[model samples]
Target: MAVIANAKVETLPEPWSGAIRSGRHQLITDKPESFGGQDQGLAPYDLICSGLISCTMITLRMYAQHKGIDLGAFQVEADFCTNKEGREWIERRVHFQSPPDEALQHKVLDICSKTPVTKTLLRSLEINTQLV
Candidate 1:
């Protein structure tokens, strides 16, 4: 199969610091100073959480458009946590500029929960990694 979107990440000179390249967009990521990395950008976990949040919003927007629903304006926030045992969890909150009808709101929430990224995270996806 052909690749859709491609990205590359490489470590910077600073420890635990790296940059990501996806198409025309570039972003830096780093551990906090407490973790011995310069407080440059978002940590890995933060980036994962952001991916979920971003994908959810995009999915919602597209769904709304397809359904001919007026979503108005909305925002999503995702908080991620990893316990000492390495168990991870994410909490997501959605806020709307103007509340929609109960039925439409429920539909939107259902769609958000079923976004590709959200489903992958919730269903314990297995990623096959290889060095090429």
Candidate 2:
């Protein structure tokens, strides 16, 4: 059984700090001074959205390749935001830009749903956090 899990622990204060890792990729993060960070790498919110977008595009490409579908010309663009519905994240808008096709729009959307990040976000999650 293959399991995918990410762990990030706060490693700094003020600007905030954390080390996040997934698969073979590991990264440290902080916010900009404007947001309490020292103008480090990507912002936390950007990281979150980018993770999802990457998974969606990768999954789409993988699925297309498997079915002998040509994806050399495939393209995708994704955007998202954090919006709490009363108290929880109940609504999200994932905009995508791919080759327009009347018959393929549904197929592409279906493939996107199978992305790991999509599944993870749509499913319940358990996060343990505390001040360091």
Candidate 3:
């Protein structure tokens, strides 16, 4: 597959903090003070969850517009969890300010499960890293 996106991260003088650059966007990632770093920004797992949540919402909105459905306002919440077996997973919840009917609700949920980020997370992924 071709490269769909790219990101570069560099460490800061502060321990456990990284400056991230992707396209025209820039952000920081850091461990919390409890993890021995200044709580400067979201940690890695939080960024993952943020991606999933945002992608799901955007996909839903796009689908709704295409189908002429009014979702009004909605919120997507996601949490990262580890089971007793040490397997990690994400739990997601969606709430609509103007709830749709049962059939539409089911359809929206089905679409959520198929969002781009959700599909990526569901499948096994390979990451190739190298030092330049």
Candidate 4:
């Protein structure tokens, strides 16, 4: 399989904080104060949600543009959830500044389910970690 993306995370001076480098961009990840972090940035789960949310938005926008559809402004929100059986999942919602028609709305919903990140999360994934 081809590697689509790669990231490097290094520990920071602050407790529970990490410096992340991916592609040409850099960002920080940290837990909230309640979790003993200084709340300097997004937590681990938040970053996961962010990836899904961003991929959804970008995929939708590209589809709309290619179809010559005006979607206007939109936002995607995702929340990590754990059920009683301890199974983890995510609840994602999309809101448009100006709502589209019923047909378009249905199409958008379908597109959301087919985003790259969405598919990745839905399927079984094997993460292999090793020390170099």
Report the C-alpha lDDT of model 1 over 6-91, residue by residue, as the tens digit: 88999899898889999899999999999898989999889889999999999999998898988898899999977999987998
Q: State the lDDT of candidate 2 residue by residue for 55-130, as single tens digits.
A: 7777877777888876555444544544566443423234444454656678877777777887888898887778
Those runs of model 1 whose alpha carbons end farther than 4 Å from true positions after fitting are: 84-86
TM-score of each: 0.88, 0.67, 0.96, 0.96
When sorted by TM-score, best at the front, the candidate numbers are: 4, 3, 1, 2
lDDT top scorer: 4
* lDDT (10s digit) by residue, model 4, range 27-68: 999999998999998899999999999999999999999999
Alpha carbon lDDT of each predicted model: 0.90, 0.66, 0.94, 0.96
Question: Which residue pairs clash in candidate 2?
Answer: 15-36, 31-37, 32-37
Per-residue lDDT of 86 in model 2: 48
Regions more than 4 Å wrong, model 4: none
Question: Against the hidden true structure, what lDDT does model 1 obtain?
Answer: 0.90
